[model samples]
Target: MPKPANDNTRFLVADVANLEAEIDALLGAFPDLQEDETLRADMLEGETSLQAVLTRLLGHEREAASMVTAIKKRADELDARKKRQERRQAAMRALMLRLMKAANLPKVPLTEATVSITKGRDSVEVLDEAALPARFLKVMKSPDKTLIGEALRAGKKVKGAAIKTGDDTLTVRAA
Candidate 1:
């Protein structure tokens, strides 16, 4: 299933925080002077209008703070979820290696396992000689469904076999 889009409030919160930080940083770097009449007019807009600005600024700051907290919380949750998936994939890879080792077959790296669903052929062959076993080498020379079916019928097993990664599906079934 597809995930829903994130809330738009997050961007607003981030913008508010950045604006606040910039305001503070500018004030600290260049202290205000009372020499300019325009500056004095804006600053001296006391009590009523200044109060409204203060109230709105406070609300924006609160929203920004809350958004930052929420983003951090979501990041931690995603990190945990990703770690769990990695561990599961690692476990499956280990199991596949063990199964192939037991079957007296050369260990096929996950990257080298180029899976395909061909209509005429049902067999698997390791093309790389360094990674290929003698039995698999013989299979590669003559690619046929009959040979593959006969091997499968005799209870011979292939390892790291699946229609897709982490599928746990057998090669015979795919065949």
Candidate 2:
């Protein structure tokens, strides 16, 4: 039987924890095993085991990243398909509306549903926005992060904002 997707990850995590504990125990018992050859062999074996577990974990990480990429591509394809369907539906609705208007049928009764064309709500159409009075327009303002960062870097202090360094990120390379 095939294992679940997360089984390998769980097993690798458990292995790493166990290997760490074993290494710690070996270090604590070093004083008691003074000059014993088995202690050196055990430590070497533990180090090897830890390396293997870490390699497996890296492999799993790569697999997870690949899955995410594949899912994103599929999502894009699905979105494109949805948009095409929406356009087709809109065109069909427009055609039906035009035909109904030509036939002077404001409402059509069908077995499953009723189709009707009613007056839409009133809306304002602006031909020249700049010519509008101040009260009829809205003013929006926002802080520019790029400018803020530039000023901060130039040794200027900004109120309610300060330069903050983020934590280091890990990068993995495939061999």
Please give, for residues 1-175, the per-residue lDDT of candidate 2 as tens digits: 2244676566776777788787677667676554676866666566547567767778777888999999999999999999999999999999989999999999999898888999889999999999999999888999899999999999999998999999887888767
lDDT of 1 by residue, 36-57 (tens): 6666445445312444554564
RMSD of each: 25.5, 6.3
Q: Clashes per prediction?
A: 0, 0
Leading candidate by lDDT: 2
Q: What's the lDDT for all of these models?
A: 0.58, 0.82
**Each prediction's TM-score versus the true structure:** 0.38, 0.76
Question: How far out, in Å, is residue 142 in model 2?
Answer: 2.6
- Residue 151: error of model 2 in Å? 1.8
Candidate 2: how many backbone clashes?
A: 0
**Could you tell me which residue pairs clash in candidate 2?**
none
True-vs-predicted CA distance for residue 159, candidate 2, Å: 1.2
**Candidate 1: lDDT of 83?**
100
